[model samples]
Target chain A: MPTLLEIHNLSIEYKTRLGTARAVDNVSITLDENKTLGLAGESGCGKSTLGRSIIRLVPYPGRILEGEILLNLDEDVPYENGVVEKGQINLLQLDGDQMRALRGKKLAYIFQDPMTSLNPMERIGKHFVEIIKAHEPDTPKEDAQVRTKDLLEALDILPERVLDYPHQFSGGMRQRVMIGLGLTLTPQLLIADEPTTSLDVIVEAQILNLISDLKDKFNLTMMLITHNLGVLAETADSIAIMYTGRIMEVAPTEALFESPQHPYTQALLQSVPDVRKPDRKLSWIPGSPPSLTEPIPGCMFRPRCPHAMEICATEPPPLMKSTSGGIVACYLYEGS
Target chain B: MMGKSITISGVFIYLRLVQESFRDRSKLWWIVLGVILGGTIALVASLIILAARSNSGLGIPVVVGTILFGVSMLVVGLFRTLLIRKGTFSPRMGTLFLVGVTCILGVITIPVSIFILPAGWFDLWTVFVMGGVAIGIILLFLYSRYSWLKERGSPGFLTITGFLMVLSIIYMTVISYWIVPYDPAAINVGPILWPPHPGFPLGTTSLGQDLLSRTIAGGGIMLQVAFLSVLICFFVGVPLGLLSSFRGGALDRVLSLIMDAIFAFPGLILAIAIAAMLGPGVINMALAIAVVYIPSYFRVLRSQVLTIKELPYVEAAKALGARDRDTMLRYVLPNSLPSIIVVMSINFADAVLTAAGLTFVGLGLPIDVADWGWDLTFGWHQLITGAWWVITFPGIMIVLLALGFTLVGEGLNEILTPMLKE
Candidate 1:
């Protein structure tokens, strides 16, 4: 499969009264077409920031210092000078209008908080119509209405309820609506930013199933940002563990979970509650993730790494090729 | 180099803005209403001039017929469009249309009663009967059409009281011209210090002007000043508030300093100072009232915008690639309107009182114009002679109008705040 999106040497910093905080630091990952990558991290670890930066929508007080977000439009497309090839557009270099046109058409975002994501004043159908009209200005209202009804029905929502306000819907239903909205234009990439974080366990499972089903049906490339390891274990084809504004490990889901190489990834696996291992207590990683405001001299996870060595404090670990068909940024894999 | 492109883009942007605003069907009626209002004013002014100069006696009926026809057309058009949008009649829209029609008729009645009405054909009793019957018919029509209003219970006590008070003010303003047995400005029309009689219900003023007619006529001028001043405050203050809050830093700081400086002084004192400086006229009085009330609006709207700008929906709009202009106009502005509306209603009461105070101090409209404040000032000495009607009736009208606005403001606050929460 062709690479759908590639991020290289991405760094983002947020200016605060205290100082500049490096929210995302030198994070690089490649997502294949029709593939789902799970980004798992604790709170304040910059996972959400990374997801937003992919679309060049870093909020105020934050700036993307350096990065290249290359999107491949098609598998067989060739790059040409000055002309935007089928799949070779660098999103970071695009102007405001170009970026706007790209969003909700080439890519769409599903926000974290479903309750507040929608405008309170607008109806569900109005939201859909606006999105459609913004991109396809000449599309007839009836066409948009038909599409909205079709999408709502596919999500098991009543087509007539499209005229209802967001407040009229329950949390899980609103989340489904959000998903439906994200897929309205059938964008190539769907960025779900902790799509099920606010939902109940059963609803979370159902939403996860719906997302996977949609992915298969549409052949979509997805980046699912969540802190839940169990959710990632079920939904992701490839998993990338983020720690303190940096990627700690990137591997296929099976390889990463079965033979987790990085100490952080291993510790993350141990923390997951298992039904079979009733006697085994969940072991937690010691110490908190390093604050982004203060620069870490070496590895970001060094403070919490049990196998920390003297070199780990003095020298930054480079992402090295591991024997288990993945990459790990740790001193343990430096020589191997 | 940049200036040239900026100007070129600016023209296109403005054109696009006009195009988008015109696309909204509801705005078309406002434009039509504005044109009609201007035409009516021109027609009425010419008719008034003709009546004052000629003995033909044709100008009054022409004015009356034209105004009646125009107003009825406006009402019919508004109701048709409103019904088309909702597909069912709404009590709120009906009430608004009725109020507008009443105001238009009231203004027209002023000239009609002065020149057209026969000497003894119409009186206060006749006006009351006509008004009561009109109101009854409207209520019956509404009740039959919207059965839900009856089932939903009686709205609220404050809301109903507020609605009735406002309706009464409109009624008074409309029928003031034809409701009196004698002209309100006719001196020596009755005995001095006369108490309430069948001909002069509130008795006659010290000048022998009918107190009841004077009180009724006072509604039009008082309401006009209050509404105009509040409107000026709304237009001036709301945009400044939205801009400063949206574009903070230097602009916000400067605006805050200016508004705070104005806010520090007592509203009435500031209005008095401004009114005294501007000299006595209706426009000057309204301008004075508007100047004092602007800071209140500025503060209310700025705070609302500050909070609303942080909502997740605003961020979502940005993520959806909506421009800053679109986000501000569609999301921030609409979300902040309910609170601003509540503030405006509250300020309407303050404006009426302040305008009256200015008039009482001889800085309002000329004494020839029938104004409650002017009547109060002229009737002050009559109070000593125990001619209570001279001062009492005008004073009551002023208090009643203010109370009406206050009740409406309070009721709107109750209704709108919960809707915002939802």
Candidate 2:
């Protein structure tokens, strides 16, 4: 499988009042072509930050310190006018305009909060026109609106709803509208950041199902960020557990669920409450994840690791192949 | 508590409220209290009128009635505000400020009337009492300006102002032209200072120019100054604010600093100062007022843009390949417009008042231009000889026009409060 995105030693930091906190540490991640990569973590574990960085939409006061995000494209990217681009573009090096041109067409972000994700004053169809005309300025208003209505119809929303403002839609409908908007330009990659976190159980299931169907329909390679292991269980192909700005484990969904490596991954799986096993004892990992502020030279999950060794406090773990058939960033995975 | 809605061309509509907050109030208590307070003021004023019965300007009943009416309005506003503060009443902060502002202006008319009218129209004691009340209203307004703007709770005030504004707009745009019997600037059309009669409906000015025509046509320059000033403020303030906050860095800091510096001064006083420097003409008067108002629009828009540019939709726009220009124009600008509109309304009212203020201070348009400010400027002298109609009419127009824009501002505060909260 060809790697669609490769983040090489990416370091992102927040210049806060107290100190510089590394939200995304010297971490490297890769996504294969047409694959669903679920990035799961406890709250504030930088999953959303990583997703935003890919599209260069990381807000101010947070800086990408040192890194290279190499996007290996099969076709010419949506490069800025007067610029030409082919395969293997380093996203970090692209100018602001060039980076912007590549955003929606090459990759789109379906943000987390659907309630505020769309413009309140704008009608749903104008939201589509804004994005469509933004990328392709020559697109006519009628053509853009027609495409939006068609997209609305496909999302199971009434095409007429596009004429209505965002407040006129329910939460689930708004989420669907957001997804439809992201998919409007048929971007190859879509990053769903906690897409269902704000929704009810029924709506969450529907949205997850919608995302998976859309993924296959659009041939999208996705980075699904959420703390809900259950959501990732059904939707994602590869599951990655992130803790304190570091990826702890990455494996095929079943492999990680059945034979999870890394203590954080195991603890995460243990926390998922299942309805099938009526009397199954539910236990959670004790001790909160460590603060990311200031450099901590060791495995970030050491304090919470029940299987922590003295060496785990001093030695930062390196990601290595585990017998479970995926990568695991733990001392246990390395040879003795 | 019910409102009447009138829609114009299916495009423009605003709610005209009947005195909603006054109902279901410990209504009897306030009305009784108001009557007591007003009765007391009127009684004192009546005594002063009797003591100084030599003046032939305003009658005893008229003076007593004006005092009674003003005091009652003041008492009603204070009562409603107090009830709302206790959380026993649900109406927001609208009418309280309205009544306070009206009383303050009503108090200002005292000095104007005294200085303009025949000597001793108001006795010394009467001046002292009115002056004290004016001070109190001014203090209350200063104290509540922030919170009052946040919510101008319903009363018939908005509706009253709305209707006034609509009427004033019609007068300026349509009725003025329709009703004017003679050209305003045409001199010797009738005898000088001729009292309103069947032939010359509003009589004639000192130059024998028809007073009705002059009063009707007079507002053109004032309106022009106000509209043009607001336009300048919008064009300069909104774009600069948008640019500053959107591309934030040193430029944002600098622009914000300058706006704040301008804002630190009193609004009308600053306009007067600028108008003094520029020397009055049409564009110069507009420019003077625009400089005073730019900071208001700029600060409002800059803060709105700062918050709005970070909204999820704007971020989404950026992620969707929107350039800085597209995101600002399509996403940020439209979202910020509602706030700008509220500001613009407030600005129009302030501009109208400030333009009048400048003119009153002799820094407004040239005296020959049939301006209300100029009319008021010169017309006041005639009040001593009992031709009160001269100053009275233009003053009424000025008040009504200012109140018109002000009503829109207050109404919009209520209308947009819900949308703004979300």
Q: What DockQ do you compute for every candidate structure?
A: 0.21, 0.40
On a 0 to 100 scale, what is the lDDT of residue B118 in model 2?
Answer: 49
lDDT of 1 by residue, B1-422 (tens): 11111111110111111122223336565575345434433432332343223332333344344345444545554564577568675555666665666565656555554565557334533453345433433343333423322221222234445555665566546555543445556778778768887556678777777666677677777788888998899999999999999988999999999999999999889899998899887678789999998988899999989998988778777766676777788788877887888899899888888888888887888666777897889789788877777787788778877877886687556545533312
lDDT of each: 0.75, 0.75
Minimum summed lDDT over a 10-residue window in model 2 chain A is located at A75-84
User: Which candidate number has the best DockQ?
Assistant: 2
Residue A199 deviation, candidate 1, in Å?
0.8
Error of 1 at B42 (Å): 37
Candidate 2, residue A163: CA error in Å? 1.7
lDDT of model 2, residue B10: 11
- Cα lDDT tens digits, model 1, A11-96, are 99999988899999998999999999999988988999998997788888899999899997653221122323475888899777
lDDT against true structure, model 1: 0.75
Best by TM-score: 1
